[model samples]
Target: MKTVIRYPILFRAHPGRTEKPKDVLVPYLHEHDVPEISEAETHIAFRSQKYALVEYDGRLFSKVGKPGSNSAEACFGHAFEKEELRRRPWWIPTIEGDKVYIRYAGQPLDNLAYYRLYLDGGDKARETMIWPALTPDYQRHLGGPRSRNEFTFQGLVDKIRDINGVQFDAGREEHRAEAERLIVIDGSYWIETTPPAICVAHEGRMIVELSHLPNWLDHDLGRQYFPLTAKDEAIEYARRAQAITQRSEEPVRNFADWTDFRFDDNPLFAFDYEGYSLKRTTFLLGGDIARAMTGNGEIEGKIGSARARAVLSAKEGARSCGADYRTWPDASDLVHDVTDAWKMTGRKPGWTEIPPKRHEFGTMICERAAQMADSMPISVSARSTWTTSP
Candidate 1:
């Protein structure tokens, strides 16, 4: 199993006026900022001094107790129950907008756009998403609203208990306004928290998944087909991709060749070789590279899966899902289970246009009809032995 890396980090709340409830930006502190967190919880003096928030996979805790209040002193009071955690919807509020900061929803996000999704401007309250998990202590620390029954939580505790707390008090605008942003969502954030073993897709679209703290040091399952930046890490990926262009032979110049790397006009890429060991094909932009699969211009442009070659669909869907078939077979069961869940819950559970793991081959065979030259050597189609996967 690939280990998910965790940063030894802390969140320190910036001091501001406490008169009215408002959002405060919390800065990320390196481990050295609070060296005590590195040791055993029982060994460290948790309440020695009111410490900053310690974070892991999103669930947080502090080192101090509330003054003159009848409350649990620290994290020891909370229950570590997946039983309950699996029931509540997990949400990541948009960073910035000066309203909320930092977000990490459970993996396999329903929409790819929401993986790193952000909200702009800090004016409106409706733009921000709310989670009931905000404890009074955390809210006070965060300088956010103190309604534990915020968002869908009120519906969970009050509305169902025959208490109309969600209703307006004498047509109070405040009450009605809060209700508007309170989006009621079902199913827990859990269902699937761990990243999939291999990239899995449902039908044609790729399934978007996330992992804890996807930074430069971490394995970012959440960031796929985004872009290869000029950062040091990206250069490594660019190296491997460039190597493909200089592979067994240079790509045919006169026609589009599948056996060789085909660069595209606008490229969307991912740095996945580190974990997946899959071949990274660089899609360069060239007029010859855009030739139709059929020798005859019977079909106007690249059709079927070929249509996915250069743009968003290919990187986000194909490479993101590990169509290269280089997954660690020992743990292939995880991929199977994730795919099954995706299919059963997908838009078309009955759809069968897609075949087995070799799904790409058949489609390519029919769509691909490219070669070097007509009178010379045979046009090398990407033909492979037909095999079935268990």
Candidate 2:
């Protein structure tokens, strides 16, 4: 199997009024502003102070927690889970329109993050908060909400402030409306609280615009087609298609010449090789390149089994399925299936009428016809070979 290497990168948040969230954007933001920020940033301490930023088109949501004053952890955890990280490089939620940033550990965010966000009040309340797993003393240091049922949104918020090391809600003390349509969320941030997440730091707010996320549910599979970017891929597609429909050639052309022929004193048939060149070419050719045994104009446009071709000019309903001579079961099956389907549907599956007028043989056809002129060619006529009138 071929291998592909994908490197993990972090986004950061910009400084503003409110303190940056530790679990999301602040860490990434630091890296963008810092020098030599790499994947290792999330693993270090002093260098892991950076952060990233991202703005999402959709809303960020949080999960609902179990009943209790300690529900804050559950709330934040839920929010974390709701963040569709895999879909977005980073995400930013807005509170009253102010941007709130979020990022990942060295690990990439998955579908679970989006689920967590919805669980939090982030979607409904439109508030931004962070949940730090690395802050060992965070719970001990920070207190809970006012009531048992009321989770301490302030505690996580405060922790985000201390660790994130950036202020996005700076001058905008009050909520403001977005400008035009391309509004930016340079107002929130995050910070690294522990080991795995440490590598996420060492960068400034990494900008992640949520509007760019992909919506898989809306993707239309019906319109999807295989890309022919490589020569091998194209060849493979053709080979698979050929395996489906048994044909002498990948592309069937010249239906009249796709058969065997012999020059016999059969008064009902006459082979017509317009020129001498085709006579020679046909004599040397063994497969479909050879002309039909009986020359009849009606067979020029017919496509059917050898048996069907043999009796084509004799009678309309006298043709056989040619199953005995078929090498591939699939070919016989298709012919039988199509024939049966057409019979049952009261519709003919193929046309056996010759064109009203033939094109000028030109040099190409002249050269080919000349080669076969000396030999009696195979012909699969749809009508009687004894008649010359249309």
Candidate 3:
């Protein structure tokens, strides 16, 4: 679904005024050929970088650039460094492949150069970072020094309120007003510019917010409401109803600690490099049991499949899969046969013990069962000294 969002262009200065420096179009406004798009929610802290935020599917994206046609690399390079892009984690999905461009409109070389860049719709997956020109009004409100000579932060806050029709509450501090204005204002602006023809709620209900709004690109409002992001200023509205719906449904589950595990602690590493399995670590042995067993000597292969099954079936079940055992046949041949049987049964022989087959209960089964029955719980001390012996 394509959702366009628009904001009023606040010129840094009223165009045609002689006193101020000529409206200097910054790199964000000038360098891009295509209208760069941003997701607003992901871009909540955008002022840190001179960019506008757009929200797509509850996630935020930012679009930064100047006016009138240039390679995306040059525009992005001027504002951000290569290292910075590399360092940005989920906040900024890395920009990969090709320089995309879009032609800009509302070009008046003279006094009217003070507009915010307009974001045009483009394929997001291919072009992760973008630069788009804005209307002069948006430029005025963002509050940065205009022209290289005298760039002071002014007019940004007022412009935001004015552009979005947000009423300032006298009860709050000015900074609070500023923040609310920016968030709500940008959200409202985006909704107006990209007025969605159809909005699907989180519960799967589809809503048509506008029957039709004037489309600035083709100048047609006959089909549905003008998307909030169109270049048109007259038809902008914030559609935060969808956002509300999304938050309301899910009971906030905070598994943040485990979900946000870092590179060094990725449990997958414990499984692939070492022999620890997730079932054995997270739930079975409390937490991070693999790390607990870091330096023990050849403890892994010493326990045979039957011993493993017996240990797992204990009251503690598979939680004790890493336990120590006494009296095991040389696992060289046994391990292979057990592993083969495991594949056929699609079960980890170390974790489950099935009844012996007819004629199979002779010596092998008895010995295996005896060893497993004798296995002991892996001690915390043993785990701390765990190791792999060649």
Candidate 4:
């Protein structure tokens, strides 16, 4: 809900004034210059001591006092020409045509103050007098005969009432709501669930439902995906894979050997001594080895010798797979072949169609894990499976 208040004031060329009036610029009044309004039962008790009017260039100009003073120096002629006035510190003097008719137009309630002063005890007729004080000049600037109702005290009162009514109606319309929903959770920012949900806070109150949240949050949260393993664990696997690959044996000796290796019925894939199979061992031991190597920025102890050799063999196998895929015309067929290779080992397919780059492959695995995590139970045992070390 929003609310706006408007204060509209129209200054008519006083009464018999001539040329088109210029805009009035009111300078800011100092604290001491303003008089305090006392609360009254029927009407507010405001006085006119804070204001003063002086004649300047055949026109009347009004000024408000500076904080502590009840009277302010006149803002025209030789006094206005002074260095202090040139600074134009607080208030902007009002000018209408060549005549300076009013000052303090920028101040809040300046016009109202004058109205109240006139009603109380000030000379209403004298205050109403206009500049260029002639009927002929008034006709030239005003364009037509002036109506009795125009620029009258009653007119100002009516304008105030009209503005107040408009603001009140606007405020009411803004707050009118179609439906209401109360939040059950106080501080929860997000919720874990299928088609996951999030909470929004407005004015210290949480909104749980999707429709009630802000537009930006709604759009971003909709596209968000959580991975199974934590991001750090995925990154660790990539680093280990990279390190192992760097130290592995080079590719086959020549094209004939590579072709013979590819077409042979009894494919002789490289295997380390333990015979657990390099790819299987790499998939299983990569996480644990990485953890031990980088645990506290140093290698804690000897990595299991057998596991290290198997990791090296896995890197060799990955290099072989990459070479084989490059010779194949169809990429999809390569993916199928890799899947078959894993199946032959009685394990899940861990490598992609193209040889997986360590970092990208690790990220893919983590994202897959996160998606899977969304459906599993919240129990600790179930959660541990996502990043369980071999």
Compose the digit string of candidate 4's lDDT tens values, residues 255-302: 111111111111121111111111222322232232223332222223
Candidate 1 Cα outliers beyond 4 Å, as residue runs = 1-149, 154-233, 236-390
* Residue 337 alpha-carbon offset, candidate 4, angstroms: 53
Residue 127 in candidate 2 has what lDDT?
A: 18
Could you estimate the TM-score for every candidate? Answer: 0.19, 0.15, 0.15, 0.13
Each candidate: RMSD to true structure? 21.2, 31.4, 27.7, 35.5
lDDT of each: 0.22, 0.23, 0.23, 0.23
Name the Cα RMSD for model 2. 31.4
lDDT of 2 at 375: 44
lDDT of 3 by residue, 1-390 (tens): 111111112223323324432222222222112222344333231222222334444423223233222522232223222222211111211123212221111111111111011111111221122112222334656784333212211323332222112211211122221122122222222221111122111122112221111112110111112222331311211122222333434432211111211122212111110011112111221111111222322322454445333322321322222111111112222222333332333232221222223123112322333343335234344575678998
Clashes of 3: 79
Q: For model 1, what is the error of residue 383's alpha carbon versus the real structure, in angstroms, after optimal superposition?
A: 28
Error of 2 at 232 (Å): 21
Model 1: how far residue 119 lies from native, Å:
21
Q: Put the candidates in lDDT order, highest first.
A: 4, 3, 2, 1
- In terms of lDDT, the poorest run of 10 residues in model 4 is 177-186
- Could you give me the TM-score of model 4 versus the true structure? 0.13
Give candidate 4 regions above 4 Å deviation: 1-153, 156-164, 167-390
